[model samples]
Target chain A: MKRNLAQVVLSTVALLIVLSAFLPDTDGGFSGIVKSADSYFPIWFSIIAVFAFVLGASSLIGSHVRKIKDRETDWQYSVVTVLSFAIVLIVGLAKLGGASGLEGDVSDPASVLGRIFSSVLSPLHATLFSLLAFYMASAAFRSFRIRSLETTVLLVSASIIIIGRLPFASKLFSFLPDALQWLRPDKLSLWMLLVPNTAGQRAVLITVSLGVIAVALKYILGMSRDMFGGQK
Target chain B: MSSDSLLLLITLVVIAAAMLRHRDRKSEVDCIPEIEVAVRKAAELNRPAYFIPGSRDIDNIQTISALSMLKVVARYCAEYDVELIIPVSKSMVMERAREVCNAAYEEAGFSDRWSSSQVSYTTDDPLGFVAHVDGMIARAKPAVCFMFGFFAGESLLLAESSYNVAEVTIAGTAVPSQIPFFVASCDTTLIGEEFFAASAMLSGNQEDIAMLQGLDAGKQLAIGIILAVVVLSYLTLIFKPEMYESFLTIVDNLLHGGGR
Candidate 1:
């Protein structure tokens, strides 16, 4: 009974908050609550979220240490994890290479931490991101096969976008009129991005909103055991 | 707002109410069947489940949706003491997943069982992350597997690895391109919007369903308004292009008024 009552109250409050997302602000209905909730929740969530970082690092260390203790195979991976973690942690926390005069905060641009981040960490991150091109190229080669009607459509779309986005494609199609040129790879790419992509994206967004509301409702109503580790 | 706009809103609201009323307790499955069973079985098996928070940055909506679904899944794991392994390809995402999972455990009153080690950050390499996740799956040998979130080629690699290991998989996301691999490999799959709807449908709350119903209402309203405009414009084009000119006039007037 108590659980049910609590569920009802929580659900009501949650529904109101979600309701605020849609309620027209011009009417001043639930907009004030929405504004205040938005303002406050981020700060609160952020505070709680910081703990997660600590917990995550600790957990990472704990797991790696366990592997070392247990002599788990691929223990070297754990070593790399710990070493990399320690390097980043120490560089940032110890204020290494900090200015001799004002030598406390390591976040200082000239500090050792900053230098390492700028020269090493930043590049490493970017280098990792650049791998997407390689992965994408590989994925394209493999998945962009002419298999079926749908696959053919995908292949065509992919070709159009790839060709249109590249300068070489534009030059290839440069013989056409201005309007045709606009439909060149570059322009077609933009049109694809703006038209079909946006339309699909918008539809997805609406569906997502509904999903969020549904999940929230399930959580509140206690009908869904996925939240509680049970069956409906 | 014009009378037309007001009418649109009214129509949307009415449709939303109807859809909400019509919503059933069970999910609406279009393609894959037994997804709920797979998800539950994965949870009930009391083993570590792997989560890939997509191979994209935090700005990706698919990643956000994946995390949201993770929230629900994490809560279940917490309640059941099921272990979860989230192999992430982004540092920021690794950080966010930790928070989300922690909150899930906290909410479930299983904070004591919540260990950071359970959700560790793998390298940002997509293939590397896939390898790490696959390794974890092998080591832990999860009973049921869920591959939700933004993914690319790595998705197939992950799913294929799971299938090779004979793990039951349920996958969902909006990326149409990856749907085939998931369909082939996963036990049950949620396509496109259904992936987004999983959290809500799984929740089974009336108000939440009502909101989803409301979205359908909004979509119907959009369709109707579009149809009306097209028909009206077509007729004007045929009979009186001059009358059709007033349509642009109203738009211009609205634009001018809004600017003021």
Candidate 2:
């Protein structure tokens, strides 16, 4: 009985949103009424999302607290977690770093929170994100193995891309034949990306888009709800 | 949408439903079994199983699909007494993840063993969430890792790091851009539509399986429709240029939000 009610609610909301897509907005009347269903619902969804942020924060807090109580390995990190949360919460709420003391925006560049974020958080974020390059290089080493025919093709394609896309490649590889002048690394690489890569991605995109529609239909009809941890 | 696109959608949906009711199709996706193996491995080792739903909020359907897979993993973990850790980007998803795991455990008669803390929200920032999960990967050293959903930016970095740490890492995403990275780094990778298939296949429910078949039917119908449209459109343009021009204008208005 409960599950059936849930299904009815789910289907109704989904159908309403889907209908709103076809309804055009017009000045005051049924169109306005229909269009607002599409427009206003997102605001409500966003509000729910904002509330969920609290639930997420509390879950993080509870887990960290358990880590502290259990003295789990790396429990000390939990202290850092708790402290950071408290500091960020207090500083932002009180606007401690604001130029106008508590009166100014917490995000004002001159404010303490802003300066701390600028000086500390931003660089830390940059450094971590930068590590991705090294990680990618490593993963590429494993991925670019020349064992199979497919891998060999991939290696050749990647090599052409790397050489072509790099600056000063034309200068370095300037000894090419006149007939092969169009084989400039950049031009060839661009052709490879624009042609094959785009074609392949587009093909997949077409397939995936259709799949999304079907999967969405299944969801709206409540056929796949059981997979989402709900009982039939 | 334009009339043609709407026609395509309706055609595909009808075809898919017909296929489901009539066809006996089966999934040939390689990663599906690999995911099963990973779950069983985690059970044997009694190590934690980490499921990263995505870096997106619950508003994203990929995140919801990830939850479906999480239910499968949670049930296996409950059955085998393996630890299941689900780290999501949104708090709302965290709530759903907890409910899924708790329900799975209850069904398995292991409700006492299920902890809501197992599903957590690390951070709202994409890379920040990646950093926390990376930390968990290093410290907990989970036996298996399941990376599934719509990933961007940090997908490769997480895949590489997970590849280095876990005994089995199976990654699936419908995003074409990320599929290559997953294929290269993970032990098993489900590319594009295969990730969608995983959702239906994991359940082993006949209706879900039928939907999977339906998706294929839709794809086939779309191909035929596109081919016929292209031929008819060009033939019209060649034989009746003025009519073709008018048709193009009509299509443009219908498709480009100008008709309103």
Candidate 3:
């Protein structure tokens, strides 16, 4: 009984959203409802997300507590995790430090939370994100191995692009004949990026957008509700 | 209905009809072999299968796609009794994920075995999620990892880390920019539309595959129309230059809100 009710509500809400997407916006009463739903649902999602944030914090804390209690291997890591979570939560919630006296946007540079974000979170994110270059290089090593024509082309394109984008490439190619200098790394990279690369990206984007549309259709029709724990 | 919505509705109807008409036929999805192999390997190794539904929230299309893909993963894992580790970046996804996993298990007559611990809400931060998954890969050492949904720069970061741990890695996403990274790092990479096709085929429902086939037909038609327009546009530029201007204007108008 509970399952059936859940399915009904799920399908009904989904169908409404789908219908609302197609509804024309006007001053009429029906359009008003659609517009309101379109406006209001995201607000509800935000509210739910805020509550879910609390739920997630609790889960993380619980896991760390379990680890600390059980004296799990390298449990000190758990202590740090829990401490960091607590500190950030408290500092942000209480608006401790920086711009605490401000009427709005208390997370100004003066607040401890704001400073931590700038000093700690920002750096950590940047450091972890910087791992992309290393990962890219590693991936390139495998991808650029000239086992086939495709890899050879890829390697050449990548090398040209890399060299072209570098600060020294223009100077490096300055010795070339003025006419032939157009084949310099920068020009070649620009042409490649503007023409072939842009075209390829556009194709991918279109294909992916169409795929998303089909998926959205399935979702709207409720044919894919098995994922929602509804009938298969 | 809006014009775009009407077109979509028509496409769905066409796809549904095709699905019903061709229910007996098999649709070729290249990822079938790898998905089957990965599922089997995870089951055999008695290791968990991890499904990361990208870093995006539920508002993103890729997350919705990823969640649908997870239903298949959940069902397969439940049947084999191999643990499925669903590490979601968003808590909302975790909530829905629990319901999905429960349903999958219950459908498999394993209602008593439904557990939400296998599915976790790790963190909302993108890189933080990556860091957590990296740790999970090193420690838990899941046999196979399915990275699906929308990904950005973190795609390679997670994939490379998973490469060091997992036996097989299958990644599917709508993000074209991330496809090259996945292709280089993962064993099997489903690029763009292939991801959607794979998701459809995973249902093992002929109707679903047929619907995908129908969409493929529509896609081909769109391509044909685009090609025809391109050829005609160039021809007009060479042979009928005056007509070319008007043609481009018509095309521009249609593209902008005129057609709608």
RMSD of each: 7.3, 3.7, 3.7
What's the distance in Å from true for residue A132, model 1? 1.2
lDDT of 2 by residue, A185-206 (tens): 8778889999999988988897
lDDT of 2 at A141: 88
**TM-score of every model versus the real structure:** 0.64, 0.88, 0.86
Give the C-alpha miss distance for residue A104 in model 3, angstroms: 5.6
Clashing pairs in 1: A164-A185, A164-A186, A165-A185, A213-B208, A214-B200, A215-B200, A217-B205, A218-B203, A218-B205
Task: In model 1, state the lDDT of residue A107.
Answer: 76
- Model 2: what is its DockQ? 0.62
Q: Compared to the true structure, candidate 1 yields what TM-score?
A: 0.64
Docking quality tier of model 3: medium
Candidate 3 structure quality by residue, lDDT tens digits, B116-209: 7777776788898999889878899999999999999889999999988999999998898899999899988889988888777776665566
Q: Which DockQ-derived CAPRI band holds candidate 1? A: incorrect
Q: Give lDDT for model 1.
A: 0.65
lDDT by residue (B183-256, candidate 1, tens digit) is: 65666678776776664555445443554564566566656755777787788888898777887566445434
On TM-score, who's better, 1 or 2? Answer: 2
lDDT per residue for candidate 2 within B1-260, as digits (tens), equals 55744765476558557645743555443336677778889888878988999888777777777787887788778888888888888888888888888888998898988988788787888878888888888888899999989899889878887887789998889888789888888988877877777877886766667777778787887688568767877988999887997776765664444555
CA lDDT of every candidate: 0.65, 0.79, 0.80
**What is the TM-score ranking, best to worst?**
2, 3, 1
Candidates' DockQ values?
Answer: 0.16, 0.62, 0.54
